[model samples]
Target: MQLAVNMLLKCSESNLIERIVWLDDQYCYVVNINEASFPYQLTLEEVIESLQNETKVIVEQDPFVISVEDHELTEAELSKREFAWAIIQSIYVIPAIFDSKLRAQLIKEASEDFGVTKKTVRQYLKRYWARGMTKNSLLPDYMNCGKTISQEKSFTKKPGRPTIYDSAIKRAPVTEEWKKIFRGALEKHYFIKSKPSLKYAYQQMLKESFSKKDFQSGVKVLDLDNAIPTFDQFYYWYRKWYKADYVVRKREGQREYLKNYRAIIGSATEDAKSIGVFAIDATIGDIYLVSTLDKNNVVGRPTIYLIVDIFSRAIVGVSVTLMNMSGESVRVALANCFDNKQAFCKRVLNMDIGEGDWPMHYIPHTILADRGSELISDSLTSLTENLNIKLSNIGPYRPELKGICESYFGILQQHLAPFLPGAVQKDFNKRGGKDYRKLAVLNIQQYTQILVRCIIYYNHRYLEGYPLSKAMIEQNVFPTPIEIFKWGLSRGNGRLIQLSSEQIRSNVLPTGDATVTAKGIRFAGLYYSSKQALKENWFSQARIKGSYKIKIQYDPQDVSVIYLRHDRRNYEVCHLVEYQSMYKNVTLEEVRLLQLNRNQQQADFEHVELNYQIQLAQEIEAIVQQAKAEDDSSLPKDIKAIRHNRKMEKELLINSKYEPNNEPPVFHITPIQKNKLSLFQAKQKEALDDDYQT
Candidate 1:
């Protein structure tokens, strides 16, 4: 019944009322060119009833009959000439025709009845006896005749202006001089960023065509006699000769014009099997979301990472985060794609999905992404290599190459984001009515849950105008993306490269290089060491001449621990030390900010030290006066000032006691000579006695 209704709707849409008509109340009359002699009359009520009952309607065959054997022939196997002879011979075989007085009358009647020319009948009768009535004898051989020429061009004149007009026009209207000037103007105007108007190009052509030069004797040389073509004439010639160039120049700024207008000779998605090519990309979501930790704090738009299968158009993985688009987000999204989504839904959202509700949980054979810094980092390359997945980047600014993933972002924004409270309007004018930031109610977790539900719904729901798979097209059915994926899987063509949780955690996480110091392995200004690292004496080992770098994988969301690849198959987990444990739940961004703050504080301390050096004496005097003013022991004394005063007094007293004298005194060498010892010994003994007295 629905099929009939749909057919009726199509017929109405196509304006086929004359061909399809409702007759009486029970039947529908269909008029067809091939069925002119016998029209079709279907019982509409009976068809609908049969459809509702899930039964078939049997169609009967026509009763009219005709055969060539009804008429007797002179020869069973007759060629064109023999058949003509047979028709002529049939007149005599009929007794009534043989009895006719005039045989010409009978032959004429036979020619009319058989729809043949009398001339052809006569020619065939003339050659009948000589050809022995055989079918092969009447066959005409074309060995003597050459190849046939096209009738339309056989008598037509050669393409070019006639000689009569050549002399009259003298030279062509678009001569070599005209072509030179027009080409120069076109190059100056059309093939440039300014993209000047056609009228301006014509003006330029005129300017170049007419030029003047100053002579050395002050006489002017000018070419003002040549007539320039009108703008319309130039436009006509340009349209005829350089239409493609004009189109290219007109659509220069539109990237899609090149993609759509130009011919693409190679297939991008057709060569891949289901789950063969996965395109990953990130976009800022339209709706605003708050931080999960603080409901009142609005984090603005979240970055959404999408991983779409090129073949099935299925969104295999998605990640919604307050973090910017970076390698970390890509890693998390890829891990989600490789891990079982059923388990993920249960663990993350606490919602149990049915078996195979989300069937995508395998690494793609090839991953396609844009040349974004986040997607093209060393970590992603290393991860893809470890997973044995090929990575490719599309040309710059060519989103159409990764169109499957790019289009999904728009689809989600159009259909889902607008319905949310904090949804941002695409047009600035539409946003004037409401404050979208104030409307933000969903946190990152809540938004993620909504995103998951939306992905599931998109997979299951039917999408119109989706390209049908080969099987679906053959079966005359339309299926959703998930259905197409399942169909491909059932045909045993889709590949599922499943990975263990450990494999995913090790290979899909972002990686960085760290060095083992005597204290521990330091990475990102923080030290991390495990019991296993200590047991293996990694720190005590001698460092190489350059950097003793080791490969480590870490989660950006948690800086507490990092995984060190100790051997081919083992990864040891190393935690931050006690002093750095405060960074346990901190993000990588926070850690970097904290390091910047510490460096800033150290700079501030150096600035203070410099100021103190310039006022050293004044600071000492201030400290001494403050200490003397607080003389009462019961009162609270300035301990810091007192310490400064004591340090200053000690330095002054030592300076006075060890003061050096440059002035010369009266000769004291006489006393040394009178002594019983050498002059040097006497002086050393005198200096020792003075030191003991002091």
Candidate 2:
């Protein structure tokens, strides 16, 4: 039967008898053995049988058999041990003895040339190749002292097949038992928190002689402590067991390291500046402010719709109203921005959500936003085409890209929000979450009021980014965008700004002629048109113009065609237009129906225009009827003819005493009457007349 053992050795014929004793497996009784000169492996049974066959006397001497124990392994039967010993001895050799021919240079060359794995080469070196190349640095002659091996209990050579008695599974030599534990038992754990080196704390702990458990636990909490490997023999076990994966070897010079670090940091900083770009987002607004000056108790916060100018960071336009942020604040804010210079917006403006696509009117350049879904709201995309913005998103993890608006809000919160008297706050629990991104709402009024006050400060204050404050003031760098507008205008800016619009000349005020007054002066949508206009049913359409600042008016439909009367262009020329805002539809039947509706509506409104021709015809008919009733004796034919002619001419002209004459008297030519020619001519005429009378 074959058997296996952990180690093996070989010896030659002449030394075999001395190296081998009988059929034992555990220990060979060595008398005088030259292991290198006589290399051989022989089973214990072969030796025993050969000895029996050769000798005259057969003596059975299984001397002093000692029991051995090791990790619960029982000794195999004699037959197996015999062969096992042969196999083990065949592999055994002096631990550090190497073949003379093997050289470190040759090993290195072979290792490189063969392209062998480091592990495999390491195994070869450990097993068969390293002895000749390595230095004997592991202490003294003690390293190879066979006497020392005999002195150690683990290495004691007992009789045939002695059980491995040490119980530590055939113990390592006393010289290396601890090293084995250090290397094997406690290495290679990656700790969660890095251990800090605490030289002073360690010194104190050592002085106090704290137990190992106490030391370990205490060291964990010290902040200044560093993960330091042991420096003394006391730490030898740790050196082998818990050796750090990384060792910090201090470089002799920092110039190269600093230069490389600077280069890396500089490269990263430079690249971060320009790579990802974003587009500006635009939003229109309508707002209402519950009059702040009013003493009445208000139910809700005053609302103001403000159109934000993302580029220069300005409020492009705004309107105050008593309406919700959506229909009122949002629309009004948008209205102010889209209005005619002198009128409120007559056309629809655009807004877009951040999704890359929107309807044609909804298209914008790009939207810069965070992960919030409202930033990509679908309702907001309704007019994306009108605003030229784009959809851009920052990486999911990055915070700096969306920092512009955040930074602005920071400024608002710091300088403005606190001053607001009645900001409302709604906790997240109350949000109900239908709108996933509703920011915690606070009373918007207080903050908005502060916002209005702060905006002037924001605009006019000398900004650090703009250096020359004096130059800015002198150059009017901080003019309100309204004053800065250079579009359509008449003579003076103040006239445009300060003109008292009640009295208009030329029957034409330069206002966009979405409306006209009774005096024939064209105005924007707001004025009271004539009572006569009411007869035409102009009032049937519930149109109302801007109450205050700029000119704007509304129609139930057909919002598209309101034109600028002075320039004679559709309102579309001014800003982006809403398509469905117009009342008109394309079909001819629709048009006819609209006209009929309009006629009926106009006639039904405040007043109506009575046709002059119809009235005149009725008057003439009345006269004819009266004459017939009078038996045709009312007048003669010639007199009636003249009177009828005069009456017809008057009716045709539709003259009234109140109407101004088209022609004015000219003084350029004057021929005096004979009596009034001159004082002398009058006297001569009087004298001649008197002589004639006499």
Candidate 3:
């Protein structure tokens, strides 16, 4: 039958008069709340008034019902049975639970509900829970009845036959003599081993007195025939004393279920082993990295959204921003994935799941993830479905299903965040750890590149799995996340390729401080030096299109490195400094030095030669005048030597004869030599020369 409040009482207190104090129309009493005293002698009107006042809460009631055919125990009987159940539960111990704490919690709840102090609640608890409490008060004098009351009547059970027994070991008013004995047992048997309840020890000692011995003196024996417990019974006393300290009582069945179920929970996340199986998940956290530039920390300690390729275990796209993550963020991250294909073996499993403008090869075959509405949003799913992706779920609240990304997030928290520049998660964004490391400043794009670089580093450079057997160094393996993605990527479409010969190559400018330097363009915040590239303008005149050395910076905001510059156009490349130097066959400084080293005196010698020639021509004019004046001495010594040599040349020319193998010899030169020697002829020429000079 339902109680007046329409209820079956569960977890309520006991007692018949306390259980059903209301009379229904059938003249049967029942309870809706805490039962009042039966008060059967009161007049009906007085009872009605009393009940009215009781509803105001000076007194309240609990629910109770009576059954015409009953199988459950009576209130009193049920309480007794529950007490036994509690006692059994208390003694049954298990691992993984702190006993005392559980007990304390139950005690606290019960005490508050019953409007009792913790001590009272615990006393009730220990009445059945603490060991040796139930078997107390067997002997007539065991309960101190002889000293405090009539021993025979007070200590005896019905008909004077003893049913329970715990004998007093000694008799005194709160005596200290037995304290030493109890203390010794506590030190050796209880306190020395674990937390000892002084109350439990007292009860244990009293129980021992009833069961084993009462006094050390041979004359004294604890009579078991009419035994009963007294305050002196150590076992009962200890239970009463430390009643509040008992451990909690858990249902045996509940514990068994838990033990077996834990394994099932662990297995829930395991996935099928098949090719093209991939799990995609996003992780938002702070990343740590050595900046490409100063090797300092860069890329803010800001929140980064990383989409890890489950197949390759590679982080294909990272969008780290100062802002919160959104659908657009996911799209951007996916968009950035194509650029990092070589670095990551992970590809999103794309099926007939037709998606956005995404290249077909980049699509995933199966996207395994949770059903978080974010993943199922039309924007996301439409793309997945369009790309022919077969979607599987890890189930809600089960992150371990996509464990690679989860583990990746964990690794980020432990290994990377701490090493990052600035106050990592707290103030990393403001300080720009990644940006500071590479560019000495934060430009959202470049900083993110730094973070991506960190991932690449983790994959290729980090040591993972087991330590090496032969070498002192560990085996460096790709990050497992990247490995997973790569495995997926390798299994996917083979039709996708880089630029082909049939297609005209569109060159992309080096981004960031990515200007063509003697070094290659900056990417992911790192400036990669390339030998083939000319300084600053390599992209502009790129006759042959090729992937330029990309200076990488992990973009904390997103997966794609910003490649520093905002523009996509190519810039003309200047000659690399090496080429200029090699072509000139000299250093620029050497050329300048040689030009500056000329002597002024050597240069003046050319003027000296020209002046000498002019003076000689004038001297020849003066010689003609001198001959008219008959002054031969005016000419300088060297010139007179040169004239004498010339005069000798004319005489030789006039007198020389040709001799050959033939018989002919020249004989005509004799007349001129003869005329030169003749004094009369010399006198005639001198007269003629004087006339001409005049």
Candidate 4:
């Protein structure tokens, strides 16, 4: 029966239970556990038959069947401890059967076999019965029988003789009167100095110990005859108590201690959801780039503006330009973040990207940036207010607050920048052997494309130590930035607030004040008025303090056209004047540089014009003199005629102007001047004829 129960328990443990089809009569049927066809059938009759056969075998091999002589020899071969333990185990196996005689017999047998006394065996048996009859109950409790003391008593301090310091002090104790003397000495000779040394303080203390009167007050004082402590004792005690205090006093008004010793507390962004917080920062890229328009012109290192999502540490947007860090770069990067990046990737790089490749295209709830002039502008403030985004400017020197973006910059320099030509090596000495500037090959457009690809790879690549979502944790998988972003959105925890392209342009673009004139709207020394802006008499409005100055938003990369904010909800596109086509493709920086050049040229023109005006005045005066000579009756006819000709030449020179066609204008000289010129010619011809006749 026990063997059958064991067999059934084993089958149940292995999940091999089958249904019992029939429980009575000649046979009992059982089906497979999983209802699958089985090769052999299991039944209760077979189990009963197997149990009967096992019972017969157990009876045949029973211990009672063994001879008494053999059992006794086996018992005698056991060791003393083994025999003792066996007796203890036997007494507890069936305590009811172990009567007085039985117990005595067991004790006698243990004593005879193991040499243990009957009295000890009896005691062991008594202990086993009194306790739970376990193996541990039969063992001795050595803790109570040993000489070990309690932990608390052993750890307690024992009273002993006085310490060495106490003995030294007993030999020559420092009295209160002696301490007063030391204080007086310190105040007079040590504390009064700019920086007092301990040795000098000790000497002063010794001197004051023998002084009769105080320095400030001429009064007699008690002298320390021989009770003064030795300099060694004084110095030891001073260091133990007053040394730190003195150092602190001497170091007062110094902030270096605070800076070096203070602990810095940091903040975290893990609690924020995707798109809840963003950190925007700019850095000069380590690699140099050539201009796309002119290869010879090294545009220098481009400033890369990066916007990172604080939660997933994902790069939301990036913009690289030869231009310096400004509000325009910030605007462009943020616009890319808030607008669809798929279209941008396609339009700019002509790369087909899936939806999950770069899922970030939403405005963040809050933005954190350094206190740069470009970031802290009125335009950013206005845009943030309009978009309902909270803008926080971290204090200067607190790069840790925006550590995510700062770390990303380092990662870019270490990982991506090194692969490109003209990449500035981190160590200056490394570049001594090679000129990195000369190695530059990529133009601005190619660099931008590479940057885009790098950003995409960073987003998709697996980042170690990335926090896992609940589902990912169960699956034992680490998530990447894209995974986190997607999981966060699926959980409905992300604030995926998207903005249209027009809305992003209107909000993220930098704004400037423009005055609308009759011809057009003049902004940045360029006109940008369209037919729509001109219609409705927008420029003819009253010239209040800022009434005529309309608010205009523009893309700094393209200055040819700007958007005029007609109202809170509307914007009008304004283009540059037709004559100002030179500025059509110019950037804001280029426009500024152009304006500077124009100002310099204007100054040069003014200088040249001043001298030309003075010379023209002199020429006009000479012409007037020549005209007066022509009318004078006292002057000779030839002289008058020559003067008249000079006047006519001057008039023609003043009247004619250079033309693009390079054709000289036909000048009609006055009738009087022409007759004077013809008479002069005829007199020359008559003189020639008279000379021939002579």
For candidate 1, the C-alpha RMSD (Å) to the true structure equals 27.0
On a 0 to 100 scale, what is the lDDT of residue 489 in model 4?
Answer: 44
Q: What TM-score does structure 4 among the candidates reach?
A: 0.45
Candidate 4: regions farther than 4 A off: 1-267, 270-275, 287-300, 321-329, 343-357, 370-386, 390-401, 414-423, 426-446, 473-478, 534-548, 577-586, 598-694
Mind giving the per-residue lDDT tens digits that candidate 2 earns over 1-694? 1111111223333322232211123222222122222222455556445555653122112111111111112123333333323322333333211222333334445456556543443334332211111111001222123422233244443223444453322312223543443333222221212333434333443333322334655633222232212224224444433323222111212333233321111111121221112222222111112222222323233444333333334333434433333432333343343333222221222221222111011111234444333333333332221122233444455655544444544454445434333333233237452221222232223333345455444534444453323533565654432222211111111111111111111011112234333322122222333333455544443334322222333321122233222211112112112333232211112233445656788878634345666788899999989978977552234453487568655754654433477443232324553334475566767877898999
* Candidate achieving higher lDDT, 2 or 3: 3
Number of the top TM-score candidate: 4
TM-scores across all candidates? Answer: 0.43, 0.23, 0.26, 0.45
Model 1 whole-model lDDT (C-alpha atoms): 0.62
C-alpha lDDT values of all predictions:
0.62, 0.31, 0.39, 0.61
In the predicted model 4, the residue pairs found to clash are none
lDDT over C-alpha atoms for residue 170 of model 2: 31
Candidate 3: tens digits of C-alpha lDDT, residues 174-261: 2344445555555455543354565665556555543554466644345556433344345543453332312111212333323332
| Top model number, lDDT | 1
lDDT for predicted candidate 4 compared with the true structure = 0.61
